[model samples]
Target: MSDQPRSYLVLASQRSGSTLLVESLRTTGQAGEPQEFFQYLPSTSLAPQPREWFAGVDDENILRLLAPWKPGTPSMETPQEWRARILDAGRTPNGVWGGKLMWNQTPLLTAWADGLAGRQADDPDAGDLKTAIEDVLGPDVLLVHVARKDTVAQAVSMWRAVQTQVWRGRADPEVDARAEYNADGIAHLHAILEDQERQWARWFGEAGVEPLEIDYHELASDTTGQVARVLVALGLDPELAPPPALQRQGNDRSNDWIERYRAERISV
Candidate 1:
């Protein structure tokens, strides 16, 4: 690849409908199709690993590209390689490409800054991911940060999901919050939610990366129009609309998670 057009990241808080947004953008083709692994973090990425628990991913070498900090994984090791991967994913083989993934820059950046200062953080995985973009995809990579209501409801919803998923024989990865909540007032969950949102918001403030802020209420209200707004912001032709190829899998349902969170907030 010629170090030309590449991909960008979508920074947002979890459960803020990021998956839905990415799906919508990719379908419209503003952002190129996300790697199949975009849904789940590929286990075998570089840097942070005690990953013995990871069996393997559906794509063998795909993890190599994603493990953006790996020593020899094309992108992480060589700027040229990283550029190539970006181009491969950014535009089409014919050169119409864009790539996007939801990322949390808070801890990711802290670890990176610490490493450059000659100290490693808990997660040694570090890479100047922005190097892979800069002027490639576009001057502005369209970092979008989303915010919703408070955390009491979020924690309740997450707890419920854990139970429901388990009952269905589909357990999510266990998180220590379960123990802490049972031990304490579940205030930890609220703290975590607020912490991450603040971290991300502060990141925008400190780093001078003014991301497009999308409120939960705005998107939920007008889906297509909001998507078009984003497309316009990204300089993608609004007339293009995302390629239908990236259409969402199912209709946006009752959104039990958001509804449950909201309802609980009222009750509280």
Candidate 2:
């Protein structure tokens, strides 16, 4: 392995099988632990909530709420310290670092990246998400864009997850609950996914980045092949054995929820 670390970003939207991909990549022990490293950042919001809920909340309270999501991160560390630690810890013995980020988390990432480069927090030049990423990762950082081809399914998944507060397995029991279907909410989520996809396409065009795109369906069907493809894209040895199987999270409940939402929309 080269002395200089190889870095990559897994750009994805919510409920897009990104977790599966990240877990698989991590199993290789070569791809690095590419998780939502910026998740604990103050401005990071995984779901929509009324602003009033956080009116009197300080950073400590926010960190407490974020504890369940961010593993291996101490609650006492400041955001800047957490950012630095995450980058260092994400690297594997093979000198490869990987990270996954959703489009909605871009603001927090941009701010962290700006600080890394010693750029002004509000600098327009520092505002470019791609540039900010490369500033810290390196100039030739590879990007893998993972998306769910079925917008309806993806939207339903996001809607259900937001309602249930169960984005993955082993979630807090206190937040575990069955999700209710909402036609308007599902439709809104679908629109948001479409807009986010378009935004990603636009950014790729502007940045001249031809990212390796992975479909959620294909990834589920052939995890090894997809992982190999990602390895090859990152100039790693593709012959490496696939990682151990990950515990599947979603189930028939998601499909049931989708059907319920579809029927509700039709009736309206």
**What TM-score would every model get versus the actual structure?**
0.54, 0.78
Writing each residue's lDDT as its tens digit, candidate 1 over 39-78 gives 2222333323212112243343322222223332322423
lDDT measured at residue 169 in model 1 versus the true structure, 0 to 100: 21
What digit string (tens of lDDT, one per residue) describes model 2 on residues 1-268? 4533388889988888888888888888888878787665454433334222233434442323322432233355544676678778888887788998887678867877776667885677777887878766778777899988788889877765665566766445455453455566667678778877888888889988888899988888888899999888777888763853575556676678777776776455
Give the winner by lDDT. 2
Global lDDT of each model?
Answer: 0.45, 0.72
Tell me model 1's lDDT, rounded to 2 decimals.
0.45
- The TM-score of predicted model 1 comes to 0.54
Off by over 4 Å in 1: 1-7, 35-43, 46-87, 90-139, 160-187, 239-268
